[model samples]
Target: MSPSLKAATAVGVLLLATACGSSNGSGSDASGLNPPDLKAQEKLGKTEGEVNLIAWAGYVEDGANNPDVDWVSDFEKETGCQVNTKTAASSDEMVSLMKTGQYDAVSASGDASLRLIASGDAAPVNTDLTPNYADVFEGLKNKDWNTVNDVAYGVPHGRGANLLMYNTEKVKPAPTSWSAVFDKGSEYKGKVTAYDSPIYIADAALYLMATQPDLGIKNPYALDRKQFDASVALLKEQNANIGEYWSDYLKEISAFKSGDSVVGTTWQVIVNAAKAEKAPVEAVLPEEGATGWSDTWMLSAKAEHPNCAYKWMDWIISPEVNAQVAEYFGEAPSNARSCELTADKDHCATYHASDEAYWKNVHYWTTPISQCIDGRTDTQCVPYAEWVQAWTGIKG
Candidate 1:
């Protein structure tokens, strides 16, 4: 599908999902699992002396990479909340860490947000307490991944799509469809790469949604047994031609630079890094659409530093800070105002931060559930736990 056509179709889906209240439900009245009885903080109070966080590596920078990249220090100084961060490499790890109840906040991706919400590991955010919440993009607010039953669970962080990256010199005609890495993967046999996670199953599910309409696969994350099996089957087939599945940026960049990977799924940041190394590569959002992520800065349900956590959430999404984080993280800023504050004037444009149409075909990752996120009551859908096992099986 052309970008415009995909966007138009996405707009329709978005409208339907919004009107229905929960993406898991069809328009009739499907709802998410009831949130546990956890109370949201009613008011902001005195800042605690310390705040510990669980986050993605780039989400919470203390200037360890470069002297000019410090946002945590300034936040700490302003609020007197000494910052301590523990980086989590995957959503499952974040979930496990949050369950320990040792952290104050987490930058939860879409896949883990619902699990946290459903398990009561995360508390509903009082947007009124976070002043910067107003500046976040309207399109990001109240989505299925961040909000439950019309209640906000976290502050919207940055977002980006998983793109198709190909070795420009080796792949002729510049492939525009996901099939180059799926259905036609044999063409690049033993040279194709993919994400190294169970969540990646959604990528195949997304492709199946576009290629095999007979499956009735509505949402990539919301797959029943039949659809889920079909997606897994496709992955098993692709696995035959896989060179290496990647979970880290540097690893994939190295693989591409060495010509071990010729084509596969990738992130914009990975593409930028590869090109910087002078590797002949290009990335695109294929016609079949793609799975993406929208992260949320969520407060722990048992937070001991509620006041400081609230302060951090508001500060992180503020114009200047958001711009810095978005640019460093290579994603579209959640705050619309952050675009103007970005050092590179073209940062927002390059990531399509403000382009709602472009995001239409980009399906943000959401946790799958038995209630059927796509609104099918006739069959139970596979959950994330099952996906983990399936991933192990496929990789084994």
Candidate 2:
């Protein structure tokens, strides 16, 4: 989708969230906790045998490339702790599955981590416990989402933005402003698409940076009452232009296939899957900047295999594992050493691992709250709390 169109639609339709509060991989609502006691879990290190993990689709795979790629196997071998995993399609699912208190760790996106922290479903990560913590880049370290009131909940993993991917054949000059999708000029009206998540409200915030600079929105996830109201108004206007707001990865691919969408907000994985199918597509990091999420490995507040979780964090962030995962996933690696280890070190370069400028403007996902966009500081802005309620009302 064009940046403007995506931004405009993002403002309108992104906040449709429905979370299932189930525990484990099972569909049962096991345990309920209002606020997770991370301290209690911190003290329960490596006491349990089987570790349950809730994560995204590709974050944990079927162990295709390496037998050891399945983190569960490697953890068992090293710490004698068994591993169990349940895949979640969205952050809402992660929250629901974690409610049962069956999973020891969860891979939460910025949008979900705050809810997890608030509910006391997840625990603060003890950096000292994981040896690999030292290798983590400061750039990705300690954000408003994972850290609340100075305590961190998880270790940083992989990161990327919700960039625009398009078929070069359709548009000659690349799209810089979010207007490509928002303006909905006669050219690509019904053919456009966007993400159907509430968290995407930030994309709208991003576009407003250029169109409505008077609001002074630095972070899309962060907003105050007046600013938030402006953003919602902008979104309501963009909603009229949207054809289909996408949630599933495959659905986005199919939209591109039918030529129903010429441009839209997409991830590296979606682009990779399309390329694998020989689809005509191209991804661009728009000039007005972008909004994205970084997946983190956080220990559960009720974790039984703390040692195993720590080990897995260290092992995965290692140069070798980072390179393998990045190459296979088609996203940039957070580890600097991964570039040196990869046979085709150029992949890291192409992904812009070394460029400080590119990432300087990229806003990592963070849930907006009453206090701040990331809920880290007290400085005021439109909090996501209001956005959620407004979005909830809209969906209802």
Candidate 3:
């Protein structure tokens, strides 16, 4: 199975098991709750000798998977901070793990970053402490996903879109819009797949933003009760057409190769892998735009190895290292300098790493809250916890 697939399955199982749980944990509470009062580091300190991290499967490679692919070793050797990593499969799991205070830092996606900030699990980053942060794409820095109240919470890592992948041999006429797997999804019933997680609700909401503009969904993540319900209704309708909801890349690859799944959502890495295996597949960012992720490397509020954690953040985003990881993980490097270091001359162009215009319509995942992230003050928006429950019901 692919790393992304593993992440999806892990997320799917966890979301199902914790579906009934309250979103009120930490950041999901009623409006007016403030993030924990934690200050960013003011100065660099002595190395703490070690750092523990919770990251997505492919983010922290130390050569265990492949001898040729190892970035953690150099980080450990350079900083003298022994690197111990825990792979988190889902955003909720990252949030849950951070709450324990056992780890020093995490590579949080937009969906989990806010919850960590609101719950006080993550600390505001002192960008000054990590000089490499200055080289990150201006488009990624201090955005709504990693910054709150004008404070930076983490260092931007990388980003990618959830593209529309279809079997060229099976899906005809070529799809340019998300409707291929949405309201018109029934046209390819029993052969469609989708990412299996509550975060996927935002994809439905994104579609509604274009197809049903009256819903007034200025932000897919900030859906009000009505908009949220409509998004959920769309998912429920889509469930019948889904041959399998995938979080595992291997399964989706197999499904497409075996002719069980012809069209649905996917990552660029998954498409690359499938095509390399001789699967007749192609992926594109549809006309309605798409949902994507920009991961942040956040320091834990209660981190034991602050100096070492800060060191890792800087090293990971450095041009050479960032290029290596971004290429390995198949996402655009957040650092602009990394583009020149990539082995594939076209890597940046292929992923639109520096294309600011291309990302204008791609909504990054963010935790939904009652206060409304989209700037509406008239109504309370649905929180992520409710999204979890609704996702469970829709799948049922």
Candidate 4:
């Protein structure tokens, strides 16, 4: 992959989010949180001869980065739609790119999907129009971050967990829990790392969910000020031993390869990238479970080539392409059938793509809103804005 393009990935997409709210004037209503009422594509039209896209780096590959990784060329050939892509560096950049309406579609993660929907930048998807949608796993459908009032906004592309990756030689006994990066992070002091985003507060919250039950954090995303403060406090303490925070997966890979980062949050692709270069590294889903992302391919509200966009969505998620992208990108394919097509027969198994038991503990990213998503009506949870504010303070 090209060095610049390689910087973009689902993980760099920050696996991020917005505050989801239930109506009480500030949140949701009887129907659900209100999204800008926009019409979804009801029927297919003739291809416009081209489509433009905003996607994470590893997606929308057309062999420009690596010959073996081409997926977009065949799509253009079969659908007669030339593909133009823009690689976004962060979840915020994606949301900003989508707002321009110059692109027809984007591969959006939970963190950015809600903002797109709420802003009317992303249109609702008629999944029926995409035949391949039927093969997608049920778990990734109509999720809180991607849906509103049960309305499906996009199609699932792929998913993965933020794991505890460590240098096998430096860390002994194979730590099984997040404590390695939290409670015991001081052991590595200058070598410890964490994701460089506010959502990381949830990692601290997830650890507290298991070890500090007194904090009363039922769901990581749904935290009141007290629970939120506690999580931030833990992060502040952790910051003392922090080596650096990473938003780019490549940087994280480089850190691990150099022994500069011995333990911290990472994605499977980073582990694979480091391993390919002969780095002695391995990732584990610690006993406390973990946080994750299931990104979606959402159509633009004012898409200039709606038909081509629809065709592209269906083509990308088709089994063989999905498998190729998943293997090359290092995440689980959303299509259940794609597992059969991966070059490495163990790809899905290695990533736990179909292991429900393994995923049950994995909390997918969501925007923390004023109304608590965890069913707590008595108190308001800290919204995403506060999360941003606290994150700035934590880093300061």
Candidate 5:
């Protein structure tokens, strides 16, 4: 799936195994999060005969998408839990399907995670029950998007960082920070490009978090009016130099290849695609960091097959399985151990799979809401709808 264009998904009714319990293991405490009063599955029980799942189109392929890309078949054979999959094409559909409460688990993106949590459609995951949780990258564990009230809501699946990609020969003095595209963007004039989603506002917010500390912007996703305005203002200024806004990799690849976009934000996949086409392009996680994308496996709060759901969660994140999913999906594996098992020995290195230090500052994209995701309670933050309106005006 092209995470950039990901929006909503479809549904499938699923039966679940029963299990219950409270969990004490929450990865990190976000400042202002307060999760719903739901408990995670405590222990494994007898597997239900069947398990229903909702996922991104390519995420749960049982060889129907392709013959060689079957992860579910092995899982079914080993666990004895029949796997039924419904692929979602958008986050809106994913949320709607999850809310139906007919499914056991879902592979949700960051944009839909909080909605699931707040709506109580998702349950906190007992990391202790999922042994594979131990190998998950520290960068993906506990944070504003998937964690709340000191409780981990799900298992991180995969990730991709938005990077600063520029044409090698055209842009002199290689940039190490985002300032190359913001403060100094005039140097490139109308040749600059950026993602076109309202979420891209977080990119400008992230740059300000480093360069304009006075704005008190801690989390790029948690912007109060002042911080939001500052971020929007920055984007408005940057708009002066923006040649075009892009929402897909091909548009960006073509722009970079034609020298129409010399420097801007991009994903590793796009850079690789450009390089293969012989484009002189290089991408980096700038010193100030970047906004990226990720997916998490979360259980249904009303899961009928809780045991099977929990087992599926653990199974999907296992090192071998994680490696397969990561490689097949073209994203960095969340399981640090998965790096060692990839068929392409350099896959981990190429995707920075285990590079905690490199990913330290990368902020995965999260949906912005009124409740401060940063944990602030004193002020109301800008919601996503406002962000969309503001983004339109900035681009206009």
Candidate 6:
């Protein structure tokens, strides 16, 4: 089966499971591109040491030791540092692990990075120590999650948008509005799917900001009382159309394959898997734009293997390694130079790695704190706390 078909089948299975219960767990406009220089930074130290890393389940894979894979052996062979990895299913799990000071690095998504930084469990990264830091796309450097007060904290890895993927056969003309999932009228009753996690509650808020002007929502992740109520009200309507909420990649794919769902919110990874599985799934970038998350490689503050951690970070972003990481992770690589190394030029085009036009409008995800959007401070919106409460109420 093609990866797409496999993904659709997986999503179908996930939908079935969700029918049983609730699941847990960029911008751009290159005008903002002022990436830091790494050439003047200190050179990397010695290798041949060990480093423990915590990351999402599928991130570090080697195709051996578990059939699914483990990526550390290759690093061990090259740097002589035995890589120890602990897989986590959610951001919460990653935070608790970091507090123990047992690991050296973490592959954290936007949702978890702030908690790591706020707790002082993760340290500000010394970009100088990682020679390959210069290769990161200028647009991704020093954002709200990884940098504070201009000091660097992590290396850009790869990124992708959360797309609306659907079966073209069932949904005609393709969906352009976020309302396709949010609206619960007769048109989409019991056919829509939503992301099952609490974090996705922000998506409903984003839709409200674009469609409803009176709420004056500056940031979807940051919500004031009225905006919060408005978003929760919208989600209550959305829940009526939603057939089920999904959490697993394969499960999401399965939903599309079986035609159990005609349309839903999804990731490029899930879409890629579905296409590889031969499912007739198409991913759409909506007209009003979309929200997305970017994951970064952050080093733990109390890392036991700091030198080895730096070495791995440097190696991961090198053109060759960046290409491999992007392809394996099924997303666009953040290294501008890696475009030349990609095996399929069309893949780069499809993924928007080389499209400056697309990046100009895409709003990269950030944790909603009092600061508001990464660069916008003209007005203060609500904080993540309000959004979290609204989300909880909506779920209830």
Alpha-carbon local distance difference test for all models: 0.80, 0.63, 0.82, 0.81, 0.77, 0.66
Across residues 336-396, which tens digit of lDDT does each residue of candidate 2 receive? 7778876555766666665657766677776565555332354665545566666654333
Compute the lDDT for candidate 5.
Answer: 0.77
User: lDDT per residue, candidate 6, 23-126, as tens digits?
Assistant: 00033111121333322225556763788888665456555424423345677798988877887766767778888999988887776676677667777787
* All candidates: TM-score: 0.91, 0.81, 0.92, 0.91, 0.86, 0.84
Among the numbered candidates, top lDDT falls to 3
Q: Assess the local accuracy of residue 148 in candidate 4 as a C-alpha lDDT between 0 and 100.
A: 77
Which residue segments of model 6 deviate by more than 4 Å? Answer: 1-44, 65-71, 370-389
Displacement of residue 221 (Cα, Å) in model 3 is 0.7
Off by over 4 Å in 1: 1-30
Tens-digit lDDT track of model 3 for 59-166: 788887767678999988888999999887778788899999999999988778888889899999999999999999987876777777778899999988889999
List residue ranges in candidate 3 displaced over 4 A. Answer: 1-33
**What is the Cα root-mean-square deviation between model 1 and the actual structure?**
7.2
lDDT comparing candidate 6 with the true structure: 0.66
How many clashing pairs does model 2 include? 27
TM-score of candidate 1 on Cα atoms, chains taken together:
0.91
Global Cα lDDT for candidate 4: 0.81
Per-residue C-alpha lDDT of model 4 across residues 59-160, encoded as one tens digit per residue: 888887666668888888898999999888677888999989899999987678877887899999999999999999877776676777778889999888
Between candidates 4 and 5, the one scoring higher on TM-score is: 4
lDDT of 5 by residue, 1-396 (tens): 332112111112111111010011223454444567987766788998789999875577687656767789988998888988887766667888999989999988777787788778899989999999998887778866678777898998988788899999999888898988899999999998987777778888888988989999878878999999998999999999999987654667788989999999877767776787678999888888777777889999988888888889998999998987877666799898898888778878888887776666677767677877666789988876688789889998
Model 1 collision count: 1
lDDT preference between candidates 4 and 6, better one: 4
User: What is the lDDT for 298 in model 3?
Assistant: 96
